[model samples]
Target chain A: MSRQLIIKGSLRRARFTLDLDLDVDLSKPLGILGATGAGKTTLLRVIAGLERDFSGRVEFCGEVWHDGDHFDRVPTHQRGLGVVFQDGRLLPGRTVESNLAFAQQRARNVNAAVSYEALTEALDLNHLLSEPAEVLSGGERQRVALARALLARPRLLLLDEPLAANDADHRQQLIGYLAEWLPAEGIPLVYVSHAAHELAQLTRQLIVLERGSVTAQGETHVLLEAQSEAIDSVARPVAAVVMSTDVEHSTATLQLDDDVAEAVLPGERVLLQRELTEDSGLGPALQPQSDENEG
Target chain B: MSGDLQAVWLTALLAATTTLLLVPLASPLAWWLARSTSPSRSVIEAVVAMPLVLPPTVLGFYLLVMLNPESAVGSLWIELTGDSLTFSFSGLVIASIIYSLPFMVQPLQAAFRAVPESVLEAAATLGAPPRDRWLNVVLPMAKRGYLTGCVLTFAHTVGEFGVVLMMGGNIPGETRVLSIAIYEHVETLNYDAAHVLALGLLGFSFLSLWLVYRYAGHRFEVVRG
Candidate 1:
């Protein structure tokens, strides 16, 4: 599974230049976390072969797509990648099924891991098949976009701030859904986000981009555990735990993950355990964790 | 009444022919005017709008001269088609197409311009080529502008008298369109016939336009380019 993408390029937009030097191996979901104007989307555009004025070399899965020295630049359509823009750019005139079908037609290079049926079922889009894309809710549109990207069978999936349009509940569900799906299918993704708090639950690989360059690249868990100099140069520490909840704020317990977890108290709760031991299955599913200790 | 009916049918025929010529030519020109950021964009835009600024006679004069089989463009076209573009119904169509080009394009370009780049990119990302992107995404999204361009081209061609007089030379049933017939009626002091023809033109214009835009989605009004 040597599905990896290595990109080094510089693209000039009106007053600023986006310079990226990155190596993203297709092993797990890769997160490019940064603030607005960090050139995160610009870098994604270069990867998708949309921005042509870029100078660099890009190799995906041992295939060279760009070699700057010889004036080799692949056009965006030929690059064989999938991209999810921040705008959830759905086709307004197309039905949800047609939108998904369009992606299926284009993704010649991708392996068909997720069927359109599975996508509609997982994203709960069965009722939306005939409706125009413009009529969908924001969350529905976002999910449809994600489903469309997956159906394209892309070797590398690029998602830019997909959760920005979602509310708290939708975001939480989507995070859990992506975590369960992206890893299980072994599909590699480059998800851009400004919030480290959001990226933590997704993957451990974090690359911090600033101004127009990479300031730090490491595992998210490692980066979250310790604030590095390169990261601190452009950002301050964000409060995070391997698994902590402010259950004390409302005195409600909820089960989140299962690795090595005991029940937790309201304040210092780490990972939630599966044993609230109430009568209904909802107790365990909705049970909150309580912990009294930490490192 | 029979005379008025004949003239009305003649105008409708001219309008239909003009619209037929507008579609293929207008689409490419309108797209270039709407989307291209190249250095030639302003030049193309100016060329498309030339008929709007130039006097109808001057445009008609140049067109007459250009289609005379003596000029290079005319000679080439004449050699290719074996028929020179002068005083013929086809010639009238060609002249009317040029005169109404800007009317066809301004609306269409505005429509194409209103389509978001995000949608185009989304189609590209989904594997549609540029041609497919235009046909599937661009055309469908800009349906209103296309409809407007068609209507305007037809209306402009129907009222076209000056260009037809200069280039077409007003031969009955060949180039003596309803507008020219009305002009002839006025010159002969036939106010009743002129009034009949003019009213017919007005009614048909209003009715045809109504048929096209009357049932258009109310949403189209506020959001249209």
Candidate 2:
């Protein structure tokens, strides 16, 4: 459908300079993969027109969103965008319902694929609706933020770790929901995450960034497989399958191949390997294939 | 109305007018002071805050020099409205606005600063334009600031004396405010009338400050600059 998002710019920060010149097709939802301080968030900020210091051209779907000059540029609000910041950034001193209402009120008048009731239900936000946004946990806040962004009915969706704060079950559920909803609605998406499995399931094309520059770019699975092999060579890894998840306790029971089951804690790092399953309605199930150097 | 009654009415009118006018005028200036990173921001802030530290007579002296009928702004006002800018109600309104500017701006600045930039960016990405963001997001978050600014401005204008005496010079039913009336009563040794007006002012000041603290929950500092 020729949905092109072109960004040719350089933004300088105190830590590092983010320089990029790329023309990406948004038809296959794009994913930006990078480590911390790798300019993933900065790149998303540039595309959303949040970085006013960015100098160059940003054109989307034949529209000139930015063109180097500070005065002459399409502002972020005018660009028909739905951006979910990493922190959620819900309006303070307001309820979750009010925050959602804020987006719904200003939503573009188009053929919306998802209704308010449906989105709230899908995100499991009916209980948290009356709660003030300030009192929400990180996971609850992200769910509300994701719902709010979808409610905006944006032409382009930019999500920066929209589900990172969520527990494994909710994260998988939302990723599955978005992987389906975005395509059905034909909304071009630019998702940023450091999780390889997330990018594999949600996005088709991937751009890996390192130190504010694109280090690798290709089809999602192909690059991920190559990256996995490279990591496998360095560290001998053990394969494990998630048997059950305790969302309340933020722990997951992983059954290793030798029949040894270990309950992994919340903040533990585990490498997720995508396993293709035909019967699993939710896309590919992310099997926790390895704990780094635990073999 | 009696002389004292007229003075009271005039004082209320002046305070109301100054408060209403300063709300719009100080909003943009305060917003700028809250957000801008320009080198000149401090200079502009200092100028806006001059009335808080400078003696009212010093400000009144400069205002008198600048707004006398012979001065450019005074002559322009005379030409436009057929009235002198000195010893007039209009003159008092202008002087009061300047005298109460810091009262309005400082509270609003602090309030605007309290609003996180991330929230504003979130509002923008939600399809709200600049005006919509300002009205819905900024205004609601800064309501306490508006409350503080309005109460302080109104109370400060009501208590104006030195500036009014120097510039607007106690013209009955024109510029004769409560403070000026009290001064006249004391000068004439009418201690009863002076006592009545003085006590009213003291009560009003205390009440205004109390309202600021009670409702706005602000520290109610006069030396915010």
- Fnat per model, in the order shown: 0.46, 0.63
Task: Tell me the tens digit of each residue's lDDT in model 2 across B52-131.
Answer: 99999999999999999999999999999999999999998999999999999999999999999999999999999999
Which candidate gets the maximum TM-score versus the true structure? 2
lDDT of 1 by residue, A1-295 (tens): 6877898878777877888778777686788866578889988887777776778887788878777753566556666667888878988778888888788877776556566777788777898888778888777888889888888777677889887666555666777777887876677788897545567787768887887788889898787545433333434222222245433232233333443332322111221221122111223223222333222
Total backbone collisions, model 1: 9
Residue A129 lDDT in candidate 2: 88
Residue B191, candidate 1: alpha-carbon lDDT: 99
* Residue range with the least summed lDDT across 10 consecutive positions in model 1 chain A: A273-282
- How high is each candidate's TM-score? 0.81, 0.89
Worst 10 residues of 1 chain B by lDDT: B216-225
Off by over 4 Å in 1: A69-72, A105-113, A228-295, B1-10, B211-225
How does model 1 score by TM-score?
A: 0.81
Query: For candidate 2, what is the recovered fraction of reference interface contacts?
Result: 0.63
Question: Backbone clashes in each candidate structure, one number apiece?
Answer: 9, 0
Computed on C-alpha atoms, the DockQ of candidate 2 is 0.35
